[model samples]
Target: MTLDEDDRQRRLPAGRKAQLAAYVAETGQVTVSALAERFGVSIDTIRRDLDQLSADGVLVRTYGGAVSQSTLSRVDRAVDVRLKMEEREKEKIAVLAASLVEDGSIVMINGGTTTLAVARNLRNHRDLTVVTNSLLVPPALSPSAVRDVYVFGGAVRTLTLATIGPVSFRASGGSELDISCDLALIGVGAVSTAAGYTTSNLAEAAMMREMISRAARVAILADSSKFGRRLFAQVSELGGADYLVTDSTPPPDLLEALAENEVELITPDTREGAPEADQDPQ
Candidate 1:
């Protein structure tokens, strides 16, 4: 079993409840009986735990069990840990997002596993100028002969492996602050129609605000699972971004919200003979 599975199977009652929340976050929803069986607890006990979690707004109570809440709790994972979670989806998202970049254009990428995948895919575009605060991103584009990679300076966040703090604003001054990038790629921790875009880390959120203001256009790169969730820190509202590139078709409500906010939803075609850069949802 994976470590998370193991954690779910053999945790103490209190720890088990916490694990349950994470599981719901991963799967979106779960039934009471399934949660009880997985956690080796009585149905009554599971119900009580769910009630507590729901009251705390960590989950939403349903008929038989619960689903994840729209807002994510203040939980974080390491960069290496997240890099292992959505490898295939991230890569596909990277390919489609990279196609948005043209030659001889400046691009700003924030720090996140999904954005890191974007950097990797853009390595062949030697003529693109890349600016980022992610330590992991600069090296990814090092091999490209036509690329110019700039790593912003600040206090490095060990967990995310990105730089943040007051120094980040200083390092990205002058021309860098002129909102000159052709594209700004961001990663969303939680996003919804009501809550808009959010991240778990406040420092990262602050830095992302600056990146958004200085970019010519903003595009959010997130997987389907990240939808309908809100994190502790608000990056911007729905209208903050110009595009959302993803692998899945968002729900109808979210699609309407995006349209109302004037944000284009970009879903790559998973079929044969589709143009790569701007294919509609399949």
Candidate 2:
């Protein structure tokens, strides 16, 4: 029997409420500004929502934000949250980035939402040696029959849930990588023609910088939202990367800026029948 449309609209499932509770508890803090922006709701609506969430003990209200009261799992807090945000753009970038990997290659992948999508697409490739500091990548690639996943060890940053420290940097640097996959797929919080790639944390920037230096080829995976944006710390110059994979067709001015720095720009085709540029020549 079909339920009344208004009744269905007014009712939310218990599981969804629980999931929202869990999300608030894991994120550490959620500000009204962030909520309003993320959900496209008014600040007053977000405040009221936070008030209800706070009363449930999932979050504690602060002056302008709410703090999580429970510990968050790395997978739940970082990987899942990221996948839900900017999902379509990341998926397009991921499919494009994965097309770069061939069989029997050793590739380094940096930690981020976009890179995680790349890892998911790499599962079918045979005899791949995947090295990554992201806690999320291993599980996604683990079940693949042809790939070997290596999880780098270091202090895990709670925000990104990726390992970073002197140890991780040194280990990544010490490896002698093959030219076949001397390619590193990296992620950044923001990218600007002026500031290059930036991250919210300094240690993450250092780790990414090390990866960039060690790899023979560097490809950056970022969405259009990252364009012209700046974060807290600069990781590398825009010229440092060999290729930039993005979902949007960049503006002419921005395209000229990237081309001037010799950065090759690639955008993926959304339609099934559309042709992709061949990476390897026949």
Candidate 3:
């Protein structure tokens, strides 16, 4: 038997709970009964442990059991590679997301290959102010459409081309104030029904949360593949976003979860043009 399987044979309620974490990582997912059987614990005890693990971010609780928070591994890919990973899907999501931005709006966008696509799609938008932490986005935007491009200063990630730092800082004139935006276009590493929105970097998650707080409305640009997967740091719950702009429909459970959080899922329609908000997203 493997280490996790051996841990299952040992009966220590408190310690077993911790070992359950190992089992989760080893097995990826497990039912409550399975945990109880593996750990030789009571069903109620296993349930409590699952609850704790979920709270601790060690696992994502499902209806039946729990899954490892790292259900999907986050491999650091170069910007060029990421752009080619889900090119068409990113284009669809970007087009739909760009349509949500109106002219003369101040928009806040974070880093990612997907959000860069959205920046490209927003090329023709006039009198718009763009604030961002991505090194690659500003060049993708059109000069005529932009009033200004406010690039956030921070340490840049070479792999993903995103900056990690404080979302709010004192102005050059030494005035302290928070920058608010009409909308926030954020792209995250992974998303799940239970764990909500998450990313690989903790600093990015914190910065994204602060960015979300300052936005009047939030739009999360993620492809369908991101659904049901989670990364290392928790960004926010599903309710954190006002809209989820994705390439395809979410699964049934995820759809219900997004609905529960009042997040409007916006997926591309079968048409050749922009999709409307009234249509079903999932």
Best-performing candidate as measured by TM-score: 3
lDDT of 3: 0.83
- List per-candidate RMSD values in Å: 11.0, 10.9, 14.0
lDDT of each: 0.79, 0.72, 0.83
Q: Pick by lDDT: which candidate is best?
A: 3
Backbone collision tally, model 1:
3
TM-score of 2: 0.66
Which stretches of model 1 miss by more than 4 angstroms? Answer: 1-74, 166-179, 270-282
Clashes of each: 3, 0, 1
Tens digit per residue, CA lDDT, model 2, 1-282: 244543343234443344445656667767779766755457886677777876665666666766665533222344544554567888788878877777887788888889987877765577888888888888767365345666767889876778886423233768744422468999888888789889878888888888888788899988998788788899889899998899986767678888999998878643344333323321
lDDT of 1 by residue, 106-148 (tens): 9989999999888777654668878888998877763653457
Report model 3's TM-score to 2 decimal places.
Answer: 0.70
User: Which digits, one per residue and each the tens of the lDDT, describe model 3 over residues 105-222?
Assistant: 9999999989988888886689999999999999988898799998887899887787888886686898876689999999987779889999888888998998999999999988
Better of 1 and 3 by lDDT: 3
Candidate 1 least-lDDT 10 residues: 273-282
